[model samples]
Target: MGLIVASGLCLALWVVLWCFHIAARDAAMISFSLFLVAAAVRTVGEQVRQSNSREG
Candidate 1:
C-alpha cells in the first residue's frame, strides 16, 4: 500500500517536471531509484510472508 502511494507520488512528480521542462534527467533518476526501492521492499515482504506461512 505504501509502495503504491509512493509510486503515485513519484509519477506525479515526473509529470510535473516534464510539463515544466525542468530537471528531466533528475526526475527520471529519482523515479527509477524509487522503483528499485519499492521492488526490493516488495520482494522482501513476500519472502517474509512465505517463510511465516511455511513455519505456521
Candidate 2:
C-alpha cells in the first residue's frame, strides 16, 4: 500500500518535470533522492498516526 502511493508520487513528479523540461540529469537524480526520503518520512508518519489512534 505504501509502496503504491510512494511510487505514484515519484512517477508524478518525474512526469511533471519531464513535461516542463525543467529538470536536468543531475537535478533529476537529486530530486528523485529527495522525493524518496520524503516518501519514506510520509510512510513512517502515517504508521505513527495510525498507531496512536489505535492506542487512544
> Which candidate has the top score in lDDT?
1
What overall lDDT, based on C-alpha atoms, would model 1 receive against the true structure?
0.94
The TM-score between candidate 1 and the true structure equals 0.60
How far does residue 30 in candidate 1 sit from its true spot (Å)? Answer: 0.2
Residue ranges of candidate 1 with Cα displaced over 4 Å? 1-22
Report the C-alpha lDDT of model 2 over 1-56, residue by residue, as the tens digit.
99999999999999998867754776898999999999999999999999999999
Candidate 2 yields a Cα-based lDDT of 0.93
lDDT of 1 by residue, 1-56 (tens): 99999999999999997877767777998999999999999999999999999999
lDDT of 1 at 49: 100
TM-score of each: 0.60, 0.54
Question: In model 1, what are the clashing residue pairs, if there are any?
Answer: none
lDDT of each: 0.94, 0.93
Error of 2 at 46 (Å): 0.2
